[model samples]
Target: MKKPSTDVLYQEESTYVDMLLRKSWSMRIAETVAFVLGMMILAQFFPSNDTTFKVLAFAIAIAVVGLAPFLYKATMRPVYKLTKTHLIVSISGKETSYPLSEVEQVYEGRHFYRLGGKKESLMVSRQFLSHLNERLFYYHKGNKRR
Candidate 1:
């Protein structure tokens, strides 16, 4: 018996997840600008005569500004993939995959597609869904290998 051909389905969320893992250039720019402004303001208010104190203040400002977007992206990345044989779901580095044959049922559940049966449910963002009619047609068209 020949195995069915497999294809992966991914939505923009996967790319966004990859981008989040990388970095946001716009956010980097914003942070740099904000940090510089913040350091200038701090120096003005603190009236620091010592060069060391001024440097420390600037360092602190940069750290605070830079930390925000990094944390935001880390916490909010969306990751999901649908393949011919399995569905991969991931967020914040935690991931899991489910075989299609193991999926006893699949349907819309809140903000995602839920696949469940055999005691556990897997949540997948609907964005990874292929065209419903096309997916159905191909999925049903495949012959099961015995």
Candidate 2:
């Protein structure tokens, strides 16, 4: 057996929101279900105006298809990997590595921790909240000793 090279300090599984954002099939399925239910309701109330209902349904379907990519990109969830020397963020199929030394601020919130740096900010989800706190303490303590 081969030993793993990199040590993973903390890992979080994909959340429900992450799945909805990252998976195209999930999003399309959800949109289709919603569209069908909406059309059914519209048909029930406005049965006489078949043209209006059909036009509305068609327009909504087009909008859903057009906006799918945008929604997926906008709501992308970053997978966080906290290591000894760096924080790895995977979002939209890209992995970005940030050195721990560059972390300027760690803001603790009720649900998440905002790790801010010079270039960008990363949100550490609640699943890794405790690990985030521990890392923040270690970083700040090292700074104080210097």
Q: Which candidate achieves the best lDDT against the true structure?
A: 2
RMSD of each: 10.9, 9.4
**Residue-level lDDT tens digits of model 1 in 17-119:** 3343334455456667777777787777676888776788868775766575456556755465666666555656776666555443333432223344433
> For each candidate, what TM-score against the reference?
0.36, 0.46
Model 2, runs deviating above 4 Å: 1-5, 17-77, 110-124, 143-146
Candidate-wise lDDT, in order:
0.52, 0.60
Q: Which candidate should be chosen as best, given TM-score against the real structure?
A: 2
Candidate 2 global Cα RMSD: 9.4
lDDT of 1 at 60: 77
